[model samples]
Target chain A: MKKLTLVLTMLTLSISISFAQEVQIHGFISQGGLYSTEYSYIAENSKDFSLDLQEIGINFQTDVSDKLHLGIQLLSRDVGVYGEGRVTVDWAYGDYYISDALKLAFGRVKNRLGLYTTIQDFDFLRTWAVLPTAIYDLGLRTVNATLDGVQIHGNLDTKLAGNLDYAITYGKLNLGRTSDIAAYAGQLTTYAVEAATTKYNLGVNAVYNTPLDGLRLNGTYLRTEQFAFDPIHQTLDLTQAGMGVLNFDYHIETDIDNIYAGAQYLFNKLEITAEYNMGTRHVKEYITGLNQTVLDMIGKGKPELSDEKYYGGYLGATYRLNQNIGVGGYYQIYMRNDDLDDEDPRKSTSDIALSLAYNIGYNMVIKLEGHFVNGLGPLSVSLNDELTGDLSDLEETWMYGVAKISYNF
Target chain B: MKTKLLPILLLLVFASAFAGEIMVANTVNPEMSAADVEKIFLGKTKKWSDGTNVIITTLKGGAVHEAFLTTFVKKQPMQFDNYWKQLVFTGQGKMPNSFATEEEMLTFISANKGAVGYVSDARAGSLPGNVKAITIK
Candidate 1:
């Protein structure tokens, strides 16, 4: 049995309960069991029941004035070698409400991606035990979770079209050295990253609440400038006639552009949603350790690689059988390299997920979910510690199950 | 698909089972439209026309709360609660002051300067001195 990292977490001990009544403070903690039949999905030990999936978050918010509000949330989690129970500032910002039409905020702001990005935390509020892996890839969560800079958002009411809520953010992605985004960049050169940052990024998300009582449509777009990844000390040894050893490094840069569109209908107890994501990542790799003669002989070719287009979508629905019991599921199709056909098993993944959740009350929820997946996209072959070295061999089909209990106040 | 749709359709059909009459009251007591009512309860409208910060109140969870959410706010009780939770966690908006009973909600509306809330029609007969019910257009 894998070690059960403390299953029950009580985070409110340090918080003054009496003061909490007056001040705005909230939190949630969840423990999950992850089991996979074959290849490891998230944690390296998920081949068996693993308790490595857990999260705890606490946030404090206050209103300085009617026009300005400030808040900060701290989060800690353990998923494989990624988080490792390290606490980090999830999001902190000061929002200045200028009017019903426009509000400005600055600091670490949530990246308003598609329907679920903004609310990735607070598991009890969502229907799925795990978000659709294709669109909400855990490996890329750090890159898509939050941005560091400024945001302007508000609502616009139109007599004809509908009520539109929109947000525009300009910032750099908050990527840590060990996050999958940075690690993936380093993997291109077979090196390790010490530091990384996105140069310039602008994102826009607009949601139109249609006149129909239960329907809404949303669209989001993100454009990023060149991303810089500084590699740790590396040495590339070459076999040549007179070359003894070469001490050199490579510079890795990439640019990403993303667009997502979706529609949702919440009719009483039935909620249905359909969304699609499409994007292209342009990777520019440079080998800096070779001499001009060596570079010429090596045929370094063009430094810039052609853009890789990726596309994916999901159709999902959830029904509240009553208030306490609800069942939900989704069918998703994803293609990592759109240039290739579905015949390429490693580049394509399709998944079917079903879940049943029970709310003990308003504050606690228990959920059990099963995922049937086909292909290698969800395995994170290039990122996971256990899965990275063995890329040549992989199962085309796999499955995993999750059981989680969460509480909040 | 039909088997899955059966439960959903039945739930949709029976959603009207949540029935009751409730009055939307506020200290500001401004004339508004049904759209305005929806926006206020949703925290989309944070201020009143006179430029006062609008304070909101609600009953924790009950038949009256469910009826109020369904009738005036046009949202499921759980959905409305989750919407506020999402906003509160995101720092977009604060959760409205929630009470266990309509009496407590009425008391909160009376004490706060620009507070707004709702109550069952049965309780609407007797009004507090400072709180007044507003008509939704």
Candidate 2:
């Protein structure tokens, strides 16, 4: 069934391309070093240096005809690492000219979750070395780069003209499997349902942007649900325990909601920008065990889990000393409250980063950046230990700098 | 000090006095709208009714060409520069052919059937025949 669906989508796209008046290709490659006190799921407390190779593929409209257009992209990253991965079809959709005042699209497209996601293509125009994680990482919790579905967009041609845009999507999201030990140890595997575990997802999102003079303010909201495998064993034992197993008849429900507002202003030789974001996550499920050993294990020492809420924001400024020389910096902060009363290692945390960049030429940019991270969370747990419950030895602060060079074709 | 500054400012103004003006040429039809003229110049219209390829000649990145773009296109100088940069970089379009003087512009336009070029209104008829001036604003 999946093969048939894929083949049909390809056939439709081929037909459209044949009759298309004009088609154009556009893209860029960005490579830089990411030095952090925290790196991955395991080394969340250790400082390390890693290189990220980011590329953005673009297919844009070259001819305007019949009020209809099409575009798509494919991107790959970390080509040589164990965690290297690729995201094909970063964006692909069709625009239907409803009228001069309105338009609609179908297929996969940019979510417009925040300012950066909308103009990710216009890298040269950006003032920051990298987008603030507070906005990009938080807003990306619900979906990947694009969603398969429908979108409606319109603009007013007046000075104070009101513009509106919205999108709703329904599709499966495969986040891949988790190898982290903490999450793995928590899984209650059952023989009965382990064979039936399937990965499928669904979600919906919307965004609104309003322009006022040289600045534009934006707001976004999203909701999603995914199927996660949970294990239910009759008992818990390190080496001696045997019991029948069954899959819990419960699904993990995930809710992701957020609001973002920002503005960009252009002065004679200076530009400034700022934005704020706030959001929360909720996971609800039910579990049970058949025996005392298992029931005692499942009920006792279970981490107090609840809905998580967090708030983050950033401020940035840029000055063009001249056409060839420019400098800028931004400060971003992210704070999270797990709502767990216990002094769990997964308590609240904060991260702050600052950067300055220079435009060597029209096609080249070099930058220096540093980060100060404090208050670690379970998200930073190291799995190298055999009996890992919580990590209390993680560092509270890490500092490093990086230089990045980029060119566009 | 006042006398010295006055002479220097006068010299600067005098040096900038010959910045010149901009005009659009009318080869096929004299009654073309400013929008239609822009369409032809931008390579969107592609051809004249006579089925000849449209040719537009202007100074490459010059003050007069910049002024013409600023007045007619409503784009900042830097933005207009970037527009052409993307077009050329993407290989979707070509830069306009350039010449040094109005006589050169007229010669190129008159020789090519679908050619269209622009010059100052004062120098419009210096060539062989009566050349119409298209509306640009």
Candidate 3:
């Protein structure tokens, strides 16, 4: 951590001295606390108040030419054990504008997956302490927040249709064992696990600004190929051959598809937004050169890995009481198996959240929020790093509250 | 009766205090419409009709800035700041220049070609020849 801080300090000083002519510096910091009544929402054991949610980031941008610019952001965040307040480079890219209607960027760019994915780290931009968790799960931030490759984005203006903004990105995602998806997969296996990685990721997002004022519609689609490796150590009692013990490694591959549609209408002091997301993940295991007995034991009665489908959405409305105060509420629902198999009662979850935000000034905001949640569904992973053998062992309902303060410049 | 008339008098006073006019550098084409001005300030239209890049400037805060935003941009001050920050951080566009007062804004606009800004009607009375107040229409 000290080394990381030194590096960031050096970079900041160098940029300030070398490019002081036209560089723009922007940053934000937020600290919040979460408390749960019966279950942990973000931390492992936060039945009481937990101060494990915070984010700090700084970004710098400078123009290289009339049509070219370079930008970079460094971030440190702590959400339970996931981020751990470890400093990491969030985005670094160069943008080249070919025209007012077309632009290209290369390097690490924020994923243009959903409306809020790119701006999720900017707490001052939104009223909620947390975005709707159903669609913008903080646990999947590593896999869904950014891509290391190229993106083409721009706006198209038309006489009859108003304007259409779009972005298409192709790149790879980096995932580790600590990531939510990898952790969930590791719990299903019997071994000590290593980090998980991905093959490639592709996404496209488009928004239409209708002729009607204060209304916009958007859609996004993303696909990724992922793989994880886990090492297993066991004793093989080959009495006939006098072999004692052996260690082996196995791996699982997953393919994921995500689709989202959303709309936002802003009129006067009231803003209403609604979004729906559906994700399907398929996993398969591979173990080669294993003894027949061990192979049979591992594969014999295990259910054929089924495609887990997730469906979630939220409808939210916020009304500004005055320039300094706002109030909002949302109803969110999520289903792991949209097919609705009666035998799986833990496949669905629902929650309602209410928030009140007060703007201390143009650069600072404070918010309080409460949530009443029903069922575990996809959020069960937050309860414990390891998943129990049966979903029935998990709590079915819970409540949590959060208070946050944020400042930006 | 006095109580009701008092509120109306205050409203008129507030309205008169905030009256302002949009201004542009003499280098601008001088043929822009209200829609074109709105598009420029919103970062939607990047260039003038002649294809030269358009530079936008604004006062950081004041009655004139708020009035300009509500009248032309149709957004609140915070909303406008958030909009530009989104564009800047997302690598979509750069933020426009902001000045703390009308004199600074007018100076920048007068010095830079293809620049546009706004000022209170009272400040517009003493504007130099190089900067002209443009009608919103």
* TM-score (chain A only) for the predictions, listed in order: 0.88, 0.72, 0.88
How should the candidates be ordered by TM-score, best one leading?
Answer: 1, 3, 2
DockQ, per model, reads 0.52, 0.06, 0.30
Question: How close to the true structure is residue A64 of candidate 2, measured as C-alpha lDDT?
Answer: 43
Interface RMSD of each: 0.9, 7.4, 1.8
Best-fitting candidate, scored by DockQ: 1
lDDT (Cα atoms) of all candidates against the true structure: 0.75, 0.48, 0.72
TM-score of model 2 relative to the true fold? 0.63
* Candidate 1 residue pairs in clash (backbone atoms < 3 Å): none
Candidate with the greatest TM-score versus the true structure: 1
Which of the predicted structures, 1 or 3, would earn the higher DockQ when compared with the native?
1
Q: Return the DockQ of model 2.
A: 0.06
Worst 10 residues of 3 chain B by lDDT: B5-14
User: Where does candidate 3 chain A have its weakest 10-residue lDDT segment?
Assistant: A178-187
In candidate 3, chain A reaches a TM of 0.88
Task: Specify the CAPRI tier of model 1.
Answer: medium
What TM-scores do the predictions have?
0.88, 0.63, 0.86
